[model samples]
Target chain A: MKTDRTPKIGFGIRKIILALVIPFIIVLIWLYATMYTSIPHGILPTIPEVGQTFVEMLKSGQMKEDILISISRVLKGYLISAVLGIFFGSLIGMYQPVKELLVPIITVIRQIPMIAWIPLIVLWCGIGETSKVVIIVLVAFFQILVNTQSGIESTPKGYIEVAKLYKLSRWKTFTKVYLPHAVPQILVGLRLGLGGSWMAVVAAELIAATSGIGYRMSSARSNMQSDVVIVCMIVVGIVGVLMDKGIGVIFAALTPWRKVENENRKEE
Target chain B: MKEAKDEIRENDNSYIINVEHLNKQFIVDKQPMEVLHDINLKIKKGEFITIVGHSGCGKSTLLKIMCGLVDYEDGIVERNGHAVVGPGPKCGMVFQDHRLLPWLKIKDNVGFGLKNLPKQEREEKVRKHLEMVGLKGFENSYPSQLSGGMSQRAAIARGLANNPTILLLDEPFGALDALTRIQMQKEILRIQEEEKTTMVMVTHDIDEAIYLGDRIVVMSARPGEIKEIIEVDKAESRKRSGAGFAAYKKRIYDYFFEDSDVEYDVEYVI
Candidate 1:
């Protein structure tokens, strides 16, 4: 309507092509390597074979079940950690006594790798999904807590001064000023926590689990079903990308002012 | 025009802010270092005063004291005949840094200090000040999206949105480019004329002091004290580059730059 002179990059065709580039390159290299190589048959499982395996797996709903299990655990563990971490983080952020007492404990726990807790967790909780959830929560909670505290601490002092001068109630100041200021940082923390929990869940499942993508991969490895394992890995990659992009979209929706700023920069 | 405003205010002996024998000393590693010494100054009903000094001078600290943002070692600051304890909405301030909440839109930032007010009223007040600062259409834009001059204007709009009786500006336009700085000075002067709020600005620019200040108060470097207060009778005409403007500029320059031995038409009040 306004002459539409600005050259906008099309997300439709361009995005599809961009998304396919890595897979295309991988398939091309696989085809070329298999075509001229002296590799034994059925051992390498050429690109076409893997594609066939992927279609068969999709049709049989093996991929779907594994994905659902993984997602459910990630969602449960990540959500719980997000709630608890923000509550405790804010408490520590606002009070010096709480911060001094808890910070050292948090730091020590955070230093211990997520995998380091896997054996103990499995032994304590048994192979029931409890251990996997515990691992995910452990990995995610630290990220959420650290980031939330950092976000609260980094809020500008001038804004707080303005709040005090305006005679805003303590609750109002936290909700209106402090909360909005910390949104972007806290969102980043959530993103990191969710992604970290995803990795931890998969690892925990790999070690001890009855069902999940990680369990499927372990079984496929034992049966020498490399194509199935590769398919599971692809599913993991795709799901991770989707989750990250979904969070990014949510960020844009919540903070439209950022979009305006980006458009301004492009004009400049 | 200025004389008429002063004359009208002369009949009402109501002093909005009274500062008496204010002294400030910063304890730097257990050493009592004095910055402001026996600084006794009074701002009447609707006066526009500007303080100009060098970097080390305590102009900023004095401004903090005036806004009750920082405490002084010894002072009696009374607002409306009541002793000042801490920052109140009666005094509004704008720092050199725009200090707009990065996450907030322009309209919301202007309403930041009006958090206690009703939502509809706050929104209306924010709109009025946005229009006053010529940012009518940029209500939804963030501080990051604004130019340096525009952000500073938004900062001024935020300060004035509170509608305080006394406005404290601490070198608000010092961060802008030369051209933008000049434009902002003119904009602020026009706003002050319209608002008629008692204003105290701290600046290091002598030319800026001459351009915007109705009266310039110069402070000495260490243990900052008011060295001279020069009244610019023809400030409107002095803003332009003419002989009268040059004479007034020379008077302030002499007060700050000239040796004590130099003879000038400066009346030392303290």
Candidate 2:
């Protein structure tokens, strides 16, 4: 299984050159769209105009506040979601009775998309920081929970039997056998949940928030300042990419054994 | 069944493991299917016992039952005169796949069952067992870092680490190549000789049974039962290419294939 393959990290110069090709093509299209087309600047800002506005936002400290505010909100909600998801997921995964009792309702709730939860959450928590964080929790929790549950559930029967043969206590077995087996999968969940948090936070801010990057985009949209809107979008994309890479780096360090494979002794 | 119990009673407490009329059933498609029926075995302390049977003969099941890894009803299976309800520390088992936890290093996997000991004592025991299995330099290596034979050696080390009175090996070298398997067989024999621990190995390989076992229990499939028990003279059976080894192989082969149309009389006799 490719399961044991060490995730390749650290882009080479050649790799960086290859990766930048698509973005460069996209920028060429953007420059053409603004300079050559009759489309108004209000609708699609010129690349230079967007870059100038980006510098203005940075100088004003507006860019820093917006990015930091959104990041902090995502972190707060993400941590709470991670804890709740893993705790409940492990219980449901380990026990048949708990899984039977909880899974059906959770499946139904997860069907309702994150955006659909915002109006109701805004009504209940009232467009404050609580509403945004709650919306994020609602969005990210299920993603983390389902992934964690599957990871724990799919632990090899042989491994569990080994633990049982050792007569390890239930808690000890979970920690040593189930938990370690599930770590890589659990990391996948945490990454997805982090991604989900950004979506939830942005959507919540666009619909109701008074501050944050999403709010800045919407306010710029209404004022016909397309350059500011484009700048916010670029900043959001960059932050999301950075956070994703950060999670990869952290989890890689945490699970060193996963990255070490013996070429001569691949498991049968 | 009554005779079986009487036989056990006649035998002294030198027997570390005793099974009288042991029967095990598993439910398949909601039907009660017997895996082991009327199994009677008595193993003395420090004796190396090998159970030989075909695949699907429930030999592995019997080994698991002995080690308290599997439950059985309507059986008198005892380890050290105590009925085995569940797995205990004294009964260590090695499985065919070398079931080492992939996440743990060889040292951690070997020391897994050595609970409630001082740090130094546990480390010492792990080091000793790893050294015993000829895996001295691989303490820091993960299970995947080792080849199949090496992994099985680590598994054997793990089994011995707990200092169990009984070690049950269920086809422990089944996954290794022929040369590696032969090497492993020699290593296990040496380990058993040095430790003097009661070793019970289950295998489908006839030669392995003759080579290592002090007594080889030949079992038949479809509700597995002991067909015959052959005593091996260590001096004679240790010579794998000698006439005595082939003679034992011939006898075990008859127990497995005699009922079938394949003729073995000409091929076996010199």
Candidate 3:
């Protein structure tokens, strides 16, 4: 009964309609530009041309292959970065010596752009899968690590003092106090790292890879198939949104206490 | 009250806690300043000792030292007949802020210090203490889900879950509103009676001190010296409107205003 009085924001079909308003306007603008303007088909594909190309790509299975290739690369790099980042982040965050030893070097290394490392990575590992994976790892690791580190480091001293009072071992303290406190923040890092890995893999493919959606886009660009390039861009955007939402759902499940806190704030 | 306290002392010469020449210093603005100076006190078993003082009076520091949460270089601070090197199961502490982990459910937070216990026993203890604190239905709730008084009740449950011989409270109810604080005070006395645990509470509220303490340790700030220790008979001091309560309040106010020209006693003319 106490929860009944709170004014709820729309999350029904109305909310979905509200969300789609901008996209609908964007499509309308695209339709108007393509139909009325004298812009060349190579520069900007007409609406019907884009729709036909999207249908053609869907029938050929080339689109599926390209999307699958890009997705798989993103997954591989994201998993590696998550594991290593959390491990080393926990270490560096917990221990002063580890932080002192790693942070300075990591800080300098993180400043180096992902694209700038492409030439060197491709030179060492060639324009193959290894270089792409390496590129994604280089891009994603710092995002995950830095976020995880700050999250772990920001655990309140009060909680640590409670852990100490209980006589918990270092590992126990980390697991019970620091880890739980940092879970939401770590998820934020993971989400950011996922986005970074996706971007990095695509960038790698554009520069050197013979596969993926990025490669498909670049190839389409070379052939002046602007409609196919637009299709690839749309797919990438949709996939990015899906990945973000998927992680968001998972993160929500992981920290149910946060939901409780929000409800408690309403009670207040 | 003096005769009763003396009788208890005679019955048990072994004090539960003994603090001798306790001196504590903290570096404030790059200068070593004394916070507690040559403090000495002895606490008997199952005694409720309330410390009343101004803010920054080192009463909290003194309580922390007794709990073995803080170290002292030059003083002897003993708990359960041993030197307080660090926090142990013999002593538990409740802070001003209810220091429950926000992520933990009430059950988990209360049972936090009971990690070494078997699972069933820990759950039983957690359940028992939660009921004792009147938070039985809130076992699954997070700390943030509870109101301020409820959070404090959970914190007290956490403190008592260890089954410590002594519980040290550093203004545990200071953050609560007036009505809730009074309610919690009554509940604390009931819990203390049931548990028979020795408690040392540092508070600024004189009424709370007088109502709860078997003996009140009045303290002055700056050097953080113990001004006086007044024994209270529960029957009289517990009655807030009674003459005995006013007498105790006046005595405490006089001690606070002794060196100053401020006439704390006021006559209201209507």
For residues B127-205, what per-residue lDDT tens digits would candidate 2 score against the true structure? 9999999899999988878888999999999999988999999999889999999999999988888988999999988
TM-score, cand. 2: 0.94
Instruction: Please state the error at residue B81 of candidate 1 in Å.
Output: 1.6
Candidate DockQ scores, in order: 0.42, 0.70, 0.70
How many Å off is the CA of A173 in candidate 2? Answer: 0.6
What is candidate 1's lDDT per residue for B1-270, written digit by digit as tens? 768766754653477777789888998899988898888776776777889988778999988887888886587877767778778887888888888877788998888888567889999999999999999999988888889899989988988898998899999989999999988888888898899988999998877887777778888878899888777775353546666676766777775768763443452210
Judging by DockQ, tell me the better candidate of 1 and 3: 3
Candidate 2 backbone clash number? 0
Q: Report the lDDT of model 1 for residue A219.
A: 87
lDDT of 1 by residue, A7-62 (tens): 43564567789999998998888788789997754456788888999999999998
DockQ (0 to 1) for model 3? 0.70
The CA lDDT at A206 in model 2 is 92
- The residue ranges of model 1 lying beyond 4 angstroms of the native Cα positions read A1-43, A92-96, B1-13, B235-239, B259-270
Ten contiguous residues with the weakest lDDT in model 1 chain B: B261-270
TM-score of 3: 0.94
Q: Give per-residue CA lDDT, model 2, range A1-268, as digits (tens).
A: 2335444233355578899999999999988888788999889888888889989999999999998999899999999999999999899889999999999999999999899988899889998899989999998888889988999999999999999998889999999999898888889999999999998898899999899999999998899998998888888889999999999999998887887653433543
TM agreement with the true structure for every prediction: 0.87, 0.94, 0.94
